[model samples]
Target: MGYQYQLTKVILVIIFWSLNEVIPIAWVFLICGASLPPLDLIISKDKYLAQFPWELYLFYGYAFYGILFQAEQHLIFLGIGYSLSRLVLYFQLKQSLNT
Candidate 1:
């Protein structure tokens, strides 16, 4: 298969995995499960002793670049949002450490 074909397949797989198409009843258990709270709150919450993982932002940079390079899609706003979030996380982490 060509690069575009492969990239499309990869994106489709990611979407499917995120949406829980891999298992018939997984979405209900994962997303619609009343026991579990929203994950965004946990991820975005500030921590006093814990350091944020900047590598995830780096992965996002890679994904944004990949989209731009392969699909000719210019997601400048998303890139800017990512950059701002990275800065916020960096400053928050810096302030958390006494050193």
Candidate 2:
């Protein structure tokens, strides 16, 4: 099912956002009626690459019932932000390197 896919993607991807970034992302979802996950989100040695708090999904307060759904929507936005930020970083580095 789509739920499995979202969980897998969340577990696998390497967006590399800090814990600080995660709170805002969750807060955004929470504001949209998605409940916040537990305070102790993850127990990973590498929290940077882990899931964005599983409790929110468990609560399922907000329903992104469209084709994309909740986590997927967040993911698309995250991907866009990641790509744009990467592009900026690459360009800035290139310019610095040329100078």
Candidate 3:
């Protein structure tokens, strides 16, 4: 199950990344942002939840397991790097949106 979960995440990320390149929409922020959904979408509670990506939870799971067990040394640094990168991306988007 663990192996399959990681494989699925890799595949999904690749697929979505490719899709984003083709679609040219800011869908990644809507799906992965730290902030609340846009005020207009407040009318539909379900829509906000639907936009939340479950893959993030899995990513956290992988990081936690890797760090706690110290089974995969690479995962810890990789996870930190990925998280920091995401943080920068999110804030950049937030600043742009605010302006």
Model 3: what TM-score? 0.40
Superposed model 2: Cα runs more than 4 Å off: 1-71
TM, every model: 0.31, 0.32, 0.40
Report residue 83 deviation for candidate 2 (angstroms). 0.6
TM-score of structure candidate 2: 0.32
Give per-residue CA lDDT, model 3, range 15-37, as digits (tens): 55766766534443333232222
True-vs-predicted CA distance for residue 27, candidate 1, Å: 31
Prediction 3 global C-alpha lDDT: 0.48
Off by over 4 Å in 3: 1-54
RMSD list, candidates in order: 12.4, 13.5, 11.3
Candidate 3 colliding pairs, count = 0
Better of 2 and 3 by TM-score: 3
Q: Which residue pairs show backbone clashes in model 3? A: none
Question: Where does candidate 3 have its weakest 10-residue lDDT segment?
Answer: 32-41
lDDT of 2 by residue, 42-96 (tens): 3222332332334334224333342345455664444344334334444554576
Sorted on TM-score, best first, the list reads 3, 2, 1
Quote the positional error of residue 70 for candidate 3 in Å: 2.3
